[model samples]
Target: MFVGHAVFAFALVAGAAAVRGVDSSRALSLGAVAAAFAAAPDVDMAYALVGVVSAQTTDALSVASQFWQTGNLVHRAMTHSVVLAPVVAVAAALWLRGRRLRRRRELVAAGALLASVVAIAAVVSGGLGLLIMALFVAVAVGIAEGTERLTDLGSRETFSTALVGLVSHPFGDLFTGLPPAMLYPFDATLLADRLSFSVDPTLNLLGAFGLELLTIWLALLVSLSLFGYSLRDAVDGRAALGAGYAVSVLLIPAPTLELSYPFVFSVLAVGMVGAAPRVGIRSRRVELPDRIAALCTGLAAVSIAGFAYTVAYLVA
Candidate 1:
């Protein structure tokens, strides 16, 4: 979901910028800034990581559960707040204003964004936790700086894009879980309940997982579209079908297996195969556009089939 957030943010900003007649290169740069901002909220997850590492968990599942539980305590609390966006943006702008200090603004922005988290973690988890979180902040800031550099966007453009991404990121969380405190500090009010479809194992695990896969595919579709590619260019129907077949085979229930394997594998398989070069002799090297189109087309076909199968299974 973290990657999804970044992809969605990039699509929105880059697509909007492109539509507004911005040059492709500049728009891409703005998208990079947006992607970085979208991912900034997750820096709070470092606290969860610290907790898991410090705990004496006996099993992998226990470790994972502990991490999830710890994360839920503060995942969308202050860092994900809409109110923090402007503060971080202003700090970033000031830091980047006159200095060509590559990515120094990103570091400043990340520090500003996570200041509250660090303070709280220092009190609740102690100095060690704070140090761990600070480490994660440094990594996040580095990523933001790297993204900006990759796009070659100016400081002002990057700052504006970051602001937009930060402002919009909290809303994206509404679909997966509890809504973020959009008006945090001032008002600790949740914006809305999470948007969820029934996916109880006894009822319809397939439907639930199918919906999740569809959401991811939709994000991928939007990303490709924003990059000026179409479904036809990214997907190969034959490859998608083959991938789907392989997934369906793997999805056949095995009582011997301990973990509950969901049908999302089929969707993933389709996407992977569709995105690859066609299994045929090519006269020349496959261009980027053609590869993307093949990938999208294959994924779309697999999604359609996967959804249909899920619906049919539920009805049966």
Candidate 2:
């Protein structure tokens, strides 16, 4: 869901900015900033690499389990907090505001708040955890700095975008595993259960996968619009070829959330058909707009095929 997080954030931030009268191109740039901030909260997953390395297991499932067990120690703690999201947003606003006004006090207060988040992370996780979270804060503030330097957007606008990206990130986890410690450091657990849309584990995994595909498709639609091309124009009828992916339902073992790599890899590989060169076509002008449209169309077709397989699997 890491890439899903970025795509979803881009659609949201860009759409919101466009609604507020920002130019489509500039709004898309703002969306890029939001996407980076949205993925920043996952820095804690870096620790999971440590576990995967330490475990002397060659099996993929064992390695994945090790990674999750270690990652869970800090994955959704301080960094995923709705509480910290606001702190980071306030810090960003103050820093940008202070820089614009040359107010030393506002700058100092912003620095203090940002530092306090790292301190809380150390208390919640541990020593190295502090460094990982500091990276998270650095990314949030750094993106703000980059936005101020690179874009015409003002401090307040940046804060709003950052706030949306950060706050929306943890909610994506609700479908996959343990729900985020939403009210972190407060001893409250408001949303503890995964929104498993079905009772059967395989069906639940498909539902989660379907939700991600839907999210990406929605983002792709908005993105194509921002690029000034309608999706209908961009998509080629050849994308129907993706329906062949359904054959995988018989070839590979049924997948659950924990061991979905085979299904995911096979299904996503269907999108590669979009990249195949057109033979004997005289129009040789290769461009991103056309290519992206083809890619999205192929992905859309494969998602439909995957959903059909899920239904057939459930019926059987």
Candidate 3:
């Protein structure tokens, strides 16, 4: 659920913005803010890099194990909590406050507020917690400041979208590992266990992987809607080409997230079908929508290839 968090956030915010009659560019800008908020929670992963550095190898399985062994120290803690969403949103908004009217009182008030937030982090998770929060807020506010400069969207929209994205993100984590610490900074269990899709380990992992793919499709669909296009327009006969990828089901070993390159590389190659649809003349420029169509078509092909491979592997 790495990118799934941001994908879901983008879909939720951007789709709603389009439905509410906001123009495309602004909606995309707002979507970027939401996506940033959704992604910021994972900044705790910086703690995991220590393991990778120590392991000193690029092997996927080794790196993943090293990552989690260390990341579990604080990965799904305070920032992932719904309780921290508003406080974080407010901190991010402070950066957007127009400062031409800067005064000692206002500056002092801001400083006090930030200091209080820092104190809370120290109490909740200690020194590493402050570092994680610092990195998280920096990334989030950087994106927010960029969004403000690039679009006319105000703090109000940012607040609402931030809440939606940050709050919704933890649910996406439920299938990957233990449910996120949804009530973090406090000791409480929300669900207590990761959701299981099947009794078989491989089947369960496949189900989760497919679920991740669905979120991507959802985000792409929302983008297409804003661009005045449909899924039908993007995916076409060329997608059938992906079926050929199923042959790899026999050629390579089965893949899990720990070692997925064989399956991932093979499936992604199916996306080349998108390049098949080209302008009649090489000299003419390709329109954005056409490029978008190609991308969607590629995704559809990837989906087909993934499904075909999964089924082939299972049945074999």
Candidate 4:
């Protein structure tokens, strides 16, 4: 799921681009909004996790003596429910709207969009768990388009692309110990238990190092492979680099992959999009940054040292 999440990010970026190509800017905005909406399930951990919520709040919430018996409040609760997806989405959109504006009319529009996503997610699943999540996104975006000030994609087009992006999230989550409850109400136990631990240090270092290396290496490879592909060509080279980046991510340890998956993939996806021209094949050749190489080397050194120290401490 670690590597899978990275793919999901890439897919989202691609979907947004696709949305931009066909629809108006406002619809594209809604697509971004949809992407954010799809990420809401993890909000259950908001009060507990450092990233989703905050460690301080999590600590405070779980400070009670009975915390251990609380059945992983964030891990396995309403957040994991398929039935709850719509509820959560609607609530979140409305809450965000409310928080942003005091107007009741604005809240109504936001809530409807959230509801639309729920239907999309369910019908889109069409029995495939992964596809359902994508459906959520498509519907959310499509509904958001209803309120668009600029332009919007036909509901069908938005629906299709959103599905492509939606399914990736659960597919990636599968690699982690916690898979999405894609069919929440029907299937309580979501995700196969192929991997253990949602966190691993070695995997984190590996992902961090591998992603950087592959992306840079692919850039070099394509340029060298082609007659005219140059260092300056940043755009066309990204897909190749993405493939390498994905491979590096897949090689990371299950636990570590889970831990660093979100941040690593997010950064890579955004970087790929922004740096496309610089890294694309259509652009002029440019030198790979020495800083990235140095960072990977440093990460490798630290990992080895940590491993050695852990072993020594254990032996002693």
The best candidate by lDDT is 2
- What tens digits encode model 2's per-residue C-alpha lDDT throughout 1-316? 8787888898888887778888888888888878877888898898889999899989977888899889887787778889889889889878877877789987898899999988987887678768887988888778878877777777777788788889999998899988888787678997968888888778888988888887788788778778887777767676777666666778888888877878888888777766666654587665433567667777767776787678668666
Model 1 ranges with Cα > 4 A deviation? 51-63, 101-144, 197-230, 239-270, 275-298
Quality of model 3 by C-alpha lDDT: 0.77
List model 1 lDDT by residue over 88-127, tens digit each.
6654554444234655655555466667655654664567
lDDT of 4 by residue, 1-316 (tens): 2233333443354444544553334434444444443453443433333333322344432442123223234443333455555454454445344434566775676566555544544554433323344343444544444423233433333334334434444544444344556665464576555343224454544444444444334323322233233333423323333223333333433324324444344334434333322343676576453433333333333333334333432343
Point out the worst 10-residue segment of candidate 4 by lDDT. 63-72
| Candidate 2 segments exceeding 4 Å error | 59-61, 99-104, 281-289
Residue-level lDDT of model 3, residues 1-316, one tens digit each, is 8788999999989988888998998888888788888988888888898888898788876777888889988888877888877776765555555322333553355445546656677888789878887777667667666766776666677677778888988999998777888887778899898898886666676778789889999899888877788778677677888888878877987776445656766787888888674544777865333677678888889888888887887898
lDDT of each: 0.61, 0.81, 0.77, 0.41
TM-score (all chains, Cα) for each model: 0.70, 0.90, 0.86, 0.39
Off by over 4 Å in 4: 1-34, 49-72, 76-147, 194-316
Global local distance difference test of model 2:
0.81
Deviation from native of the Cα of residue 157 in model 3, angstroms: 0.9
